[model samples]
Target: MAGKLSVLAVVALATAAVFPSSVSAQPPLPPGPVTMIVGWPAGGPSDAVARLVGAHMAKALNQPVMIDNRAGAGGNIGSDAAARARADGSTIMLATVASHGLNSALYTRLNHDPLKDFAPIGLITTSPSVLLVPRDSPLHSVRELIEKARAQPGKLNYGSGGVGSSQHLAGASFKKLAGVDIAHIPYKGTAPAMTDLMAGRVDLVLTTGAMSFIRSNKVRALAVAAPRRLPALPDVPTFDEAGLKGFHTDSWYGLVAPAGTPRPVLEQLNAALATALRDPELERQFSEQGSLPVKPMGVDEFWNFVRKQMPTAAEQVRISGAKAE
Candidate 1:
């Protein structure tokens, strides 16, 4: 009995040494407010998600989470700032697919490395782009639109928020897969592109933030660029279902702190992010806006996910032939 007890005691000590309790492993953030940088203008999708998730994270961290918008260079401006911020848990950034995934492939020179410059905390939400046309337009389906584009070739045009934006890539992907020659019109932002789409100045648009217009019947969603249909737009068909077999694109947001932030601090921030995402009300709000929170994941797992997405983003950038302005 004594021998058995001794062996059990040794095993327990070894286990404790290898894995500490969560309560002791996580350290508190710095005293002042945590600034969350958004690499887009306020009132944009990334800003909206940051404000929502930051409000909930503030409750979890018991510190005010301030949103700082640093809009420019396709999210590079804010991302560069976040990459340079001190790694003391005082600052973080709301990263997007644009910043971490596509920009590296789109821009020839960047100040910061997407993978090495930051530590991924967790994914916030994903917004899938939808193929939209004016409600009163004669084209009612993706097939019709593709046929028209094929017939007119460069005479037809599609509009996007910018050169390397997800919208542009989606439209590019459509042109590649459908083998059509449609001219691309780049606007300052999606708002202007959407306005042009409605006014018939542009033939079509692929955007993530046009759900309200779809719901209000102002625009008709011909297809969604996702494997499955969105709950908010169930009536819409997937691109695959609409005759384009293997098309997909999404705009995603995630939380990240500067690289070299202590692993424990990263763990703490990820925990707070997971807790905030668990709020049923937050999930409801996200769904109402046609966004979906990502499934829970630990810090390293989230980083791994981001790493795996880079190659695909690069391929899309190549397909789009987009260059930074």
Candidate 2:
């Protein structure tokens, strides 16, 4: 028994020397420039946040951080690429509610598993949308809109940025919770939808940066799907306050690395991310874009935050009845 124990100890020592454990093997810097994958087009909010975060992370890592834009298939293309990346700390993804939450339920088949293929670094920000109508619309409030929708059914229509977008989900949730029928009009993008909403072509829209439009007297924000009244739009009531119990939705963005990354490396990345998000400059930029920072959290806490949103996203996908096979 003593001889056997000695042999086993020798084998373990050899393994440790040959393959440094995750703790000890962690590299101070990536072997190459780190790729930060953005699943959306350049110049959008997601891309802007990615570049800002990447700049700070580059400083922290002392390595060049590259932003790779692979916008397509409603954020699935880049998401799938990130999922297939090696577990080495070099490749990471800038994930959003669409990639990590909604797409799981929206697509009939996805190459990547949103929750399992990657490690949740941390949530960066969440942009809440407000339920809006034309300033001259006959509906005055959420209740009135619902009443009219129920009375006229498909006659009332709402426009969204695209099918399966957070905007679409918000509208679907309103229809489901209010027990009304509102036809959905899919647009190429939100700008056109907002244009039509102002032109009285669409009956309603859910807007994120409603301050300018509301201030311009172009749209009337009846209720918001937010935790509280937006400081910029104080008069807009929350869905809860507007009498729609438990209704909530937001476009949340988060950071993640491919699964199996070394724990020490991921910890460093998470720390860097948390620090960058708290920067005063980043805070000002987020506010200007109408995005609010998600509360700071450690890695484990951030996982919980990401996990908690999955079910809500699934429910929204179901309500939207959107599918991409």
Candidate 3:
């Protein structure tokens, strides 16, 4: 009995030494101001979404979250900056559809890889594009636009934010699916594209629903590139309903950190974002802008989404003949 008791005591001590309680204890997250990099100018869809989510993220983290707009080069300037930033949790990016997924396919010689340079935090929201034409223009619907383009091949011109932007891809997708010939006019940004579309300088523009012209009726919404009709514009038909079946394109926003960021920090940000997504006020605000709040997914899911989207976007870029220069 004495020998057995001694052996049991020895085993307990050995176990305790090998597995200290502190071993399981997690260190508290580092403290500092967190910066969200926006790859576009202020007041744009990505900027607005970043500001909104950043506000909630700041509150959740108990630290100020600042939005730094580093716009240029079709979102490459800001994205590249974020990609090269230190893996410390302080710097993250609000990556848009273009920077996170489409730019790889669009730019022939991109400086960084979206998948390799950043760790995805989570998906934030998705907003569909609205096809708009001048109110006084003869085009009344998607069918009308298609008919016009078919009738006058290579005559109808459409404007986009840039060569590889979501607007450009949406327009190109429409042309391919609808079998119409149209000229693409690349502008500096969506605002400028919308400006020309409203002025009747361009025949059409596929822009985000946030465009003032769409709400003010300066430009008429001929169709939306979504699976279903938006609540804000119930009367406007989706491209699928408007005779372009299987047509869908959305402008998505997500959070990402420089690769090699700590897993705990990523989890913390994802938790805060999940909480923010549940807030009713934020939901209402997002809905007003035609954005749908997406459920937060883990790093793997976000990466999976990127992988699935990049190839399709690349194919679209090839089909559209959209070049970086």
Give the candidates in order of lDDT, highest first.
1, 3, 2
Q: Per-residue lDDT for 1-325 in model 3, tens only? A: 9999999999999998787554234333468789899877776667788998999878888888999988778888888999999787789998878987678877778888898889878889999988889889998988888998999999999998776678888888788888989888987667677778879999998877464566777889888888989887888899888888888887888999998887777888888888888888888888887787687787789879977887777776787666675
Model 1 is weakest, by summed lDDT over 10 consecutive residues, at 20-29
Q: TM-score for model 3?
A: 0.86
**Going through the candidates in order, what is the number of backbone clashes in each?**
0, 0, 0
- Model 3 poorest ten-residue lDDT run: 20-29
TM-score of each: 0.85, 0.78, 0.86
Tens digit per residue, CA lDDT, model 1, 1-325: 9999999999999998899776566556778799999876665566678899999999999999999988766778888999999997899999888888888888889999998899878888888888888878899898999899888879888887776667777888789889989888876557678888888888899878676677888888899888998888888899999998988888888999999887888888999999999999889878866786679789888888899998989988887666665
| Residue 119, candidate 3: alpha-carbon lDDT | 89
Cα RMSD (angstroms) for every candidate in the order listed? 6.1, 4.9, 4.3
In model 2, residue pairs whose N, Cα or C atoms come closer than 3 Å (at least 3 residues apart or on different chains), thus clashing, are: none
Model 1 residue 274 lDDT?
94
lDDT of each: 0.84, 0.79, 0.82
